[model samples]
Target: MGWLRAAVLGANDGIVSTASLVLGVAAAHGSAQSVLIAGIAGLVAGSMSMAAGEYVSVHSQADSERAELERERHELQTDVEAEHKELAAIYASRGLDPVLARQVADQLMAHDALDAHARDELGITEAFRARPLQAAAASALSFAVGSALPLLMVALTPASMLLPLVFATSLVFLAVLGALAAWAGGAPMGVGTLRITFWGALAMAITAGVGMLFGVSG
Candidate 1:
């Protein structure tokens, strides 16, 4: 579930971007070969970009967490008493009585001091730890899958009807993807579908307009 949000975002971007590219090319009266080429190139580039971006972002998070843990480790070694008191104070602030807080802190430290402090004080839990590789893989795979839908439409549709067909199909695909994503996350499906469809339509429209203007001028 941790990767779900990132995967959804990656997929949505892939669909919008590749579809928009295809529609834009088609709008400019480009040949089917040209449209297919553009779509394929966009899909490959987008997937790689998503993978790299997710890896860098998640790796940064992991680095920060490691740095914080190192700092905590140094503090624990240099001033054990201060670290104990600090943990006790944290628990006390959360609602425990002062005496009970201290007792609980002592027990936690005796069991696994760093783990307890990382979880309670630093808010870095195992469940939420960043995994760069996992994030990168999820992002790339989802993007590729989403990008494929529009490219597949291009391959199947006639060149004369390419623009409208891709636009219609892409919107439907985006809506369904958004609804499924929202439903999986326990959100309102209708809202998600509408939101995605609106944005996707806007992207394609803007791109198509630009391509037409440029194509005519060029």
Candidate 2:
């Protein structure tokens, strides 16, 4: 689920930002070939950037988690009895009776002291641990895939109708991406789709207007 959110966000940003860039350039009176070239360049750059950024960020987070886990493990080893009491108290605070909490904590500590403390005290779980490489790859791949759609439209569409066609198509793609993201995250699909499309349309519109203004002035 976390990976899904990262992938979707990567893809969505790729699509919206690249589309906006291409539209702005196209409105500035560039040739279709030029626009296509720019779009492709943007896609490649954006994907690589996203991947690198995600990698670095996730790696930092993973390091932090590992450091915390190591500290907890050392604490548990140095003072097992105290750690046990701490775990029991945590459980008791969460509504368990004192005797039952102590028994449960002892049992958990016996099985895996570090795991128990990390999970209960530090709120660190294997399920939520960061994966730097996986996140980076997912971000890069998804960004490239998303960027390709608008780039393809720009390349294949007739120049006479390129702007409008690209605008409309990109909005549809953004909406689809939003709906998919929302569904994956167990959110309201319609609301997510509408929100994405609305913002995407506004960005493209603003870029196009600015481009046209620049073109006329030039």
Candidate 3:
């Protein structure tokens, strides 16, 4: 589930944004065609944006991790004693006795100097390691899937019922998604559901209001 966070976030954004866009246009008394077009446009734009953003962010994290590992590797090559002492100090600070810390560090270094330093010193681990392509794909695919839900409502629902249906359905989807994501992350499901629903409601409300205001003035 390394990609769960990005996937959940991307899907949440996709649902909220496309639903909000559809609601706004519908509130403006736009035709079915206009609403569908807006939703589709929002979906495409949001998916691409999420992909690019995740790629850049994860790539930066990967770069930083690589840089730290390389620095540690160089230190191991040029100053093995210093690296060993530094690692021992880390273990000592973590509550091991001085002698025990030194012994533990020596054992770990003997087994794998680079890995020991990378995990303990640089705080890099296999589980949390950044993968740019994985993150990008997860974000993009999740977004498209989420966006499709609201757009489906637009396609099926009549113009008069479009706003209400999309609003209600989107909120339900967001709440369910939030709860599921929270469960995955071992957090409180209720809190996550409420948080996502509240934001989705607010986004739709604001956008719908704007659309109405313009509609009235025009």
User: Per-prediction TM-score, please?
Assistant: 0.93, 0.95, 0.96
Q: After superposition, how far is residue 210 of candidate 2 from its true place, in Å?
A: 2.4
Which pairs, if any, clash in model 1? none
Clashes counted in candidate 3 amount to 0
Model 1 scores what on Cα lDDT? 0.92
- Ranked by TM-score from best down, the candidates are 3, 2, 1
lDDT string for model 3 (9-118, tens) is 89999999999998888888888998899899999999999999999999999999999999999999999999999999999999999999999999999999999999
Compared to the true structure, candidate 2 yields what TM-score? 0.95
Model 3 CA lDDT for position 173: 95
Model 1 Cα lDDT, one tens digit per residue, 1-218: 54787799889998999999988888888889999999999999999999999999999999999999999999989999999999999999999999999999999999999998899889999989988998898999999999999999999998888888889999999999999998998999999999999999999999999989978987
User: How far is 168's C-alpha from truth in model 1 (Å)?
Assistant: 1.7
Question: What's the ranking of the predictions by lDDT, best on top?
Answer: 3, 1, 2
For model 1 the TM-score comes to 0.93
Candidate 3: give the clashing pairs.
none
Residue-level error in angstroms, candidate 3, position 50: 0.5
Question: lDDT of all predictions, in order shown?
Answer: 0.92, 0.90, 0.93
Candidate number that wins on lDDT, 1 or 2: 1
